[model samples]
Target: MWSQTTDKQRNLERKKEQILTEIKAVQQLLKTEKTKERNVLSEIQDQNHKIKLSQDLIRNGQQQIALINRDVEKNQAEVAVLEKELKALKEDYAKTIVKSYKSRSSQSRIMFVLSSENFAQAYKRVQYMKQYANYRKKQGDEVREKSDALAVVIKSLEEKKVRQNVLLREAEVQKKNLEAERTKQQGLMALIQKDQRKYNDQIKKKRTETAAIDKQIQQLIREAIAEANRKAREAREAAAKAAGKKTGEKVVESSKGSNTAVFELTPEGKVVANSFKANQGRLPWPVSKGYISLRYGDQPHPVQKHLTIHNSGVEISTVVGTRARSVFQGEVLQVQVLSGNNKAVLIQHGDYITVYQNLSDVYVKKGDKVTLKQEIGVVNTNASGQTVLKFLLSHNTTIHNPQSWLSGSN
Candidate 1:
């Protein structure tokens, strides 16, 4: 029972620490200045992060309060049991004292033995007196022991109550903070709605930039697949020629009218591809902790209901300077630096490709081997002061939803 209570306390501490970290992250974001002029879009993004962190903190506070309540209840029950036991012990001890006092005289004890009819009877009478004295002594000791235990339990119960009260107060404070942040977010949204046209224009411009990035990524995947197939074909031809066999011309199949195509790999590449595919949904997250700001595929804009946004991958929002890591063990295929966007790292795990974009700098380069969860680069804090990573997954040339591949939860 004590171990379980201790475990709960430890878990509560961890959750509290996590809440603190998120609060700090929000504060950090607030401190950062957007690279571009302040606009509704940027303001909305910043406020959205603040609102998210506040909500998370509120949840943590709720959990903490619940844990404290359980502890308080357990301690109260323990106190009650101890009090009852102590009371019974005290009564038993008092009864023994009263009975002993009634026969307290040494002379009376001697008379009790002398009154026996025979020597054997007298000896038994003396032993009975001694046993009674011992019983009384034992009862007194037990009462003392139980009294001490009750005192300890009472102290513990008091402490638990104090802790519960503190937690309740903290939870109330967190609720207030969450409410305030939510109100602020609502105000920001209303302002954006007031200038709906401007907001829609900004969203359109962002969508255009996103489309451009997706195009570049798809093109890169296609080129890499073509190159891998070429190498494999050459290797096959060399082996055939060495065996004195006729090398018939065979062309790799292409997927026409599609941006993606299958990658033909050498024997070694096939093994890597197989391993990558086997992991599937078990892949680690690119960032240590973050939430998905934009999910894969087309979705309505947050501010403009009529506007639809297309995304090739999930956009994860994290604290500034958060390092983006490799989801799986792979070799870096390319390190691309966009005109406005910072940089992007493309990694190949067999025929599968993972892209990490919106990086401020690169820690790994082209052809460099990376291990699973290895830091690839730091995520960029954009002009709007939003630190986000645009992550994509693809097999050969076909794009896959990264959320399906990444481990569940933040």
Candidate 2:
């Protein structure tokens, strides 16, 4: 039970550290954003994130305190039991010592052995005296061991108390900070609410733009799939000709249609597809350091509760000048320029595809092989001074949440 509690405490401490690091990053981003032209909605969102992190940090601290309290209570109980045992041991040892002192004379010891009915009895008496002396030594050792144990438990209890106090202080500080963030968020919210109509229009326009981009992306993916199937079909036909079989053989018949949206994988392509599928939920992040700013699918807008925002992919907010990296090794399928001069990189892992969008620049061209975590392009820092990488994952044209595929999503 004690070991389990200690493990829980250690885990909570680690979580607290992570929360603190996230809070620090949010603070730095907020500071940087403040230096630029202020976007009230963005500021509110960042402030809200910081507040959430602060609350997590405080809750983690409280949990740590709770574990420490459990430990302190357990140690105190142990100390009490050890003190009682030590006290009894010492009392018994003291009595033994006093009795031995009164009979400490060598003459008295010799008389003890001699007082027997016969020689056999006298030998038994001598053995009894030796055993008595050993018993006294054992009692003294017990007293010392118990004393040492009591001292150690007391020390441990003191240390736990100290840690508990420290966590309490830290939690208090976090609470204050959280309250301040909440106040600032309220102010930002008011400012946004005052111009809510303008902000809402802007958000709708942005959503329309994103929808168009998504449509373009889907079309590109379809084209890429068709191209891949065409190549596979060509290869099969060539092989059939080499074997003196008609080009209309059954093996080459599967890829005949132009409307085949899914990939017709070759043996090698099947291997890559299987490998990619096997690594689900363990793929690396598209960027080295960032937090998911916007998750996949439909979510309520941050400021406008009535408005719903649909995201085709997850948006990761990263530091400025951060380069987007490949999550896995794949062949670059397409590098297309989208609206606003932003670029998107699509890499194909067999039938699986990973997309990195909103890049300011591109590094790889079509059909180029890229390794895992290879830097592909710089993520664009938007007008609001936020550098975000919009990442998507899919099997053929079926979209999957990138967060679920990325490592440490839990």
Candidate 3:
């Protein structure tokens, strides 16, 4: 139970550290936003994220404190038991020492052996004296061991108390910070509410624009899949002709009008796809530092609560001028320009494709083979000054939640 509690506390500490780091990142991003023309909605969302992280840090600290308290109680109990045992051992040893001292004289020991009736009785008496001496030594050793154990338990209890106090102080500080952030968030919300209609319209317009971009991305992926399949079919037909088989016509007919929902992966493509699948939940983030400001799928608007916002991918908020990197090694299949002159890079890993969008500048072109974490482009800082990378993962035309594939904390 003690070890289990320690493990749990350690895990909480690690989680607390991660939360603190994310909170710092969010604060930095907020500072950056403050320097630029403030986008109220974005600021509110960032504030909300900061508040959530602060709450998590406080909660984690509380759990750690709870675990420490548990351990402290357990250690105190153990110390008490050891103290009792050591006291009894010392008392017994003292009594034994006094009794042995009374028979300490060499003449008394000789007399004890002489009093025996026969040789066997004398031998037995000798054995008893030796055994008593050994018992006294063993008792002394046990007393020392118990003393050491009690000291250790007492020290552990003291340390746990210290840790508990530290965590309580941290929690208090976090609570104060959380309260301040909540007040700030409310003020931002009030600002939005004052112009609620205008913000709502803006949000709706943004959602519509996002929808259009998502549609274009979907169409581009579908076309890419079709083109890949067409190339594969041509390759097969050419191979058949080279082998002197009249199978080119059959090959071409077989691929006609086939739904381009899935890629016709070659052997090499299959290997890459398998490797990508194997690394699900372990892939590196496309950027070195960021947090997911908007998650995948549908979520209510941060400020306009009644409005629903659908995202085809996660929006990661990061520092401006951050270079977007590839999550895995793959061939760049396409680099298409989206609305607002923002560009999207699609890299194919077998049947799977990973998209990095909202890039301001491209670093690699089509057919370029990029290594893991290779910088593909510069992330765009929009007119509002928020630098967000819209990242998406898909198996051919079907989108998957990128968060599920990303490693560790956002």
TM-score of model 2 (CA atoms):
0.95
User: CA lDDT of 300 in candidate 3?
Assistant: 91
Worst 10 residues of 3 by lDDT: 246-255
- Per-candidate clashes, comma-separated: 2, 0, 0
- Over 232-323, each residue of candidate 1 has an lDDT whose tens digit, in order, gives 66776667666654555454543333223886666778898999898888898899987677789988875565888888999887887899
- The lowest-lDDT stretch of 10 consecutive residues in candidate 1 is 251-260
For candidate 2, write residues 265-380 as lDDT tens digits.
87888899899888888999899887787889999976677889999899988888999999888899999999674899999999999999999989999999999999999999
Candidate 3 lDDT over residue span 1-410, tens digit each: 76787689788878888888899999998888888888999999999999999988888988888788778878878988998899999999999999999999999999999999999999999999999999999999999999988888888888888888998999999999999999999899889879988988889899999999999999989988887788888887778766655543433335476457999888999999999999999999999998999999998987787888899999999988999999999999889999765899999999999999999999999889999999999999976678999999999888999999999844
The local distance difference test score of each candidate is 0.79, 0.86, 0.90
RMSD in angstroms, all models?
4.4, 2.2, 2.2
| Steric clash pairs (candidate 2) | none
What does candidate 3 score on TM? 0.95
Residue 70, candidate 2: C-alpha displacement in angstroms = 0.9
